[model samples]
Target: MTQFHAYQNRNPASRERYPYLLDIQSDLLGELRTTVVVPLCPADLAENMRLSHLNPSLEIDGRRYVAMTQELAGIERKRLGKTVHDLGSYREQIIASIDFLMSGI
Candidate 1:
């Protein structure tokens, strides 16, 4: 999957809490079997949390979901379900968040 493509979470174990998984994997690794993703859980669940840079708030399908960037993971490409939408509008914020995670700048 291309970068910033939000996908439905197929796993029932965490579906309620994390309805979407934003694929942050670069398009350059198309041949790779695994893709990196960050879960998007309901922002209400994280109402008390204040780590904006680490977990930016995002709105998808009319619901507010927080990007759980700190929980980034690599899973099988097939694991991601149907596409939610392209997060092109949030690209800069996402990139900056990733940069902050890596360099703290």
Candidate 2:
């Protein structure tokens, strides 16, 4: 049986096409969170998240789920258009969003 089958066998209708790789980051204080999501397999998902020094959340099918925080995960859901050449500036916006969400804005 395939690794995917172990997690997805219960639902044969599931497809790998829409699988998402999510990465989450937070300060040591756990007061800040940032996230990025890409399309990739579970192994690569863990690798990339590790490279970014963040923990990961795993899910199988739409019924079962794992997450650090919905709002933190929601950051990647809102795309920022084309990639920004200036990551410093872009990073500011991301940090601001995290702060806003955490502050209950």
- On lDDT, the leading prediction is 1
TM-scores, one per candidate? 0.93, 0.24
**Model 1 over residues 6-68: C-alpha lDDT tens digits?**
999999999988889998888999899999998988999977764888888888877788888
RMSD per model, one decimal: 1.1, 15.8
Candidate No. with top TM-score: 1
Per-residue CA lDDT of model 2 for 1-105, tens digit only, reads 101111111122322422332233432423333334322234432443332212223334423222222223223322323221222323443344445546745
List runs of model 2 lying over 4 Å from the truth: 1-70, 74-89
Deviating ranges (above 4 Å) for candidate 1: none
Instruction: Judge candidate 1 against the unseen true structure and give its global Cα lDDT, from 0 to 1.
Output: 0.87
lDDT at position 71, candidate 2: 26
- Deviation in angstroms for 105 in model 1? 1.6
